[model samples]
Target: MKIEAHEVERRVETFKAAVQEAGLKLTHQRLEVFRELASSADHPDAHGIYDSVKHRLPTVSLDTVYRTLRTLSDLGLINMLGTAGESIRFDANTRKHHHFVCVNCGLVRDFENEELSALQVQEDLVGFGRVLETQIEVRGICNDCRNKS
Candidate 1:
């Protein structure tokens, strides 16, 4: 998606509001960390986030990244995912979407099939509660990785 600068600013404000709503203090470091996650197309892990921001913030610690990731995930600002025996990664997009994980490289990519969401679940399947989130994570080797093998 081609996000405009104005949109980025708007999102920043939205994030701040969310933080405030959660009774959290808005700090510069937190904003920077949250912005990176919100703006990134890649759903990177804590390590990836630390690596990306380390250049700008020489003194930023890994602990800060981990804490921010947890806070953001709790605030519904990002989605966190983890594969079997793999590190957790974050997705900035908050809209209902699914993911496709490349087992070969452990890369997580967004995959949306409208038909899946359009389908209705059986009443018996969810007897007591309503569906709040419907995210699917499919694991397989990516085409590029498969071709390389």
Candidate 2:
């Protein structure tokens, strides 16, 4: 799904402020890379991001995209999805939400659940450490994939 132009601008501005606060250069490449991700809801991996960024920036390298994504993730401007052993995907939506993952075709869609978002952590879990956040991943075959069967 495509985000609104205003929302995209807001995110880009946030990125700019974060980059400045983190003592990082706000280069053209970094701006383009973040714009590419911010405008997309596909939850693209580094390679997917590189593919789009390279079109607009012929001088951009795959390694640069990878490093930029890593930096953005480290700055909490974007989210890194996927479990261990799975390809890491990036999401620019930083709001409180969950994911509906298509196990068959690998589509990741955002969803919101008030109950889930408000769920309290168990005492046993809290005993281990402080809980920073919570999110649920609902896995199922997407309509397109199911229809193909």
Candidate 3:
């Protein structure tokens, strides 16, 4: 889940552009929040992000972080994973991929399978509307946690 330095710069620029396109000012708080997310492989919740950003920008509030995350998600700058138990995690990689969530440790890692990515969901299958995106979450014990047992 480690992002290359070049990729991190690219992501930040892309996110900034998206925000500008949405008629929003690229505030300092938003930039710091984006940088924290761009540098983390571990998907973090709003509080986690706020905590990290607060180290550098001590005046930042948790509410501002939450609102910034929501804005980024709304603009498709990042992905909001609200299904990972009660905590909502945020992912910087918006590309097509799935997640393998460790039930014991609550670790979420990206998993990309060509077959899964190419899957086409028929609307009749679920009697639902069109599928804009597809993400599969597999819950199980991670190797690290299993080894500790």
TM-score of each: 0.78, 0.89, 0.89
Q: How far is candidate 1 from the true structure (C-alpha RMSD, Å)?
A: 3.3
From the highest TM-score down, the ranking of the candidates is: 3, 2, 1
Per-residue lDDT of model 3, residues 3-67, tens digit only:
78987888898888888888988989889999899878788999999988999988889998998
Of the pair 1 and 2, which is ahead by lDDT? 2
Per-residue lDDT of model 1, residues 1-149, tens digit only: 23357656777888888888889888878888877776665687899889878887888999989988898888787778766576788876665567787788876666678876565665455567776656677889988899999
Candidates' C-alpha lDDT = 0.77, 0.88, 0.86
Clashing pairs in 3: none
- What digit string (tens of lDDT, one per residue) describes model 2 on residues 75-121? 88889996667778999888889999888878888888999999877
* Number of clashing residue pairs, candidate 2: 0
Q: Flag clash pairs in model 2.
A: none
Better of 2 and 3 by lDDT: 2
- Score candidate 1 by TM-score against the native: 0.78
Off by over 4 Å in 1: 1-13, 122-131
| Per-prediction tally of clashes | 0, 0, 0
**Model 2 stretches with alpha carbons more than 4 Å out:** 123-128
